[model samples]
Target: MTAAVAVIGTGTAAGWGRHRLGRLVAEQTPERAWFHVHPPHHDLWGAREPVVCDAQLLDCFAAGLRAELPVVVSAAPPKPDGPTQRSYAGLAALSRPSGRILVGVHPADAARVPFAAAGCGLLSRAVPGLPTGAREVHGEVAVEALPGWMVGTDASGEPVTVNLPPGATVLVCGAGAAEVVSTVAVTGRTVGSVAGADVA
Candidate 1:
């Protein structure tokens, strides 16, 4: 087994007045996989509403990822295809100073969704020895396997950096009474192995 850390994402069809942590490890939602643990560890969200993710928990997650395994794959279906015409104004433009990215990855190719609205933006720095594949969102760029070990802030995902040794089990907590448990597995083309094994 490897180590993995879950980060907060968007909300879902969850209850109102409750913050739902986006927990997905390979496009598999908590409803689908038991390993997804992006919920609260304690009664943090008990009487409160609009639960904010714990910064300390994020730190713990980042630590677990440092020495563990991290394989970034599509944990959800690629965003739906729409008009090539892109729009970026109002809060959408300001809220995301770094903009957003959408991608679809397969064993063969990964397509990158082009953000034509933002014609020019610096691409993320190179991840020296990781696998690379194109995203199928047309004019998009290749989606690099996000570093699970050492990570720098990009303002986009602004993901928490977790440092874990090989085969570490991490407990994650989120709003309400929810929790997710996840781990990372290491191997050469190890991502493929873990994904295949997971599917099985």
Candidate 2:
């Protein structure tokens, strides 16, 4: 069985948070692979060349899941159109039975979250604020009142907060968020366990 598969997206084209979360999941897994579907023109940090396919990106993603390896698919924001919507629907069907997850990073692709959540076995969201490079905090982001154990820091530099209910996880990355400096500190703390459980 595939350990885990995640489709990550962000509202903006920059994709910093989306990439960060994907990288985090990849780092935590034992033998992980990266795939970029509909990749941007600029080079991605750890992803390989684009996996183009006639099915509007579903083939490559399906291949990854079938490999039974921990994989992350970096995709464009989901659209409501026929082809795009069907592709996401296909993603959900492939992921759910295998017990994987889909992530919507901060400033998530609002259009994609619902489809992603429906298709995957589990759904996680990095909420509150988009990861920023500013040295000092510009403003406060409102953390959602989710129900589970929350990981990651708030804008005030607090250690942890409570949100994201069971069978789900939430990672908070506010403006001026640490650039995921340590996998142990960020992903390893939360996502590592999530992936590890599924793999076992």
In model 2, the worst 10-residue window by lDDT is: 35-44
Give candidate 2 regions above 4 Å deviation.
1-114, 117-122, 133-185, 188-200
The local lDDT score (0 to 100) that residue 36 gets in candidate 1 is 14
| lDDT (tens digit, per residue) of candidate 1 on 13-125 | 33321222222232331111111111111222121111122333223333433322112221231122222111211112222112122212221211111121112211211
Candidate 2 local distance difference test against the native = 0.29
lDDT of 2 by residue, 1-200 (tens): 23332232324434776566645644543332221112111221222222222232333334333322122332322222454334333433321121112222222233343333323322334322222221111122111111112244468964343322333333437763333212222221234344322100
Candidate 2: residue 88 Cα off by (Å)? 35
* CA lDDT scores, all candidates in order: 0.22, 0.29
Q: List the residue pairs that clash in candidate 2.
A: 92-119, 147-165, 148-163, 148-164, 148-165
The Cα error of candidate 2 at residue 112, in Å, is 7.0
| Model 2 error, position 101 (Å) | 13
lDDT of 1 at 178: 25
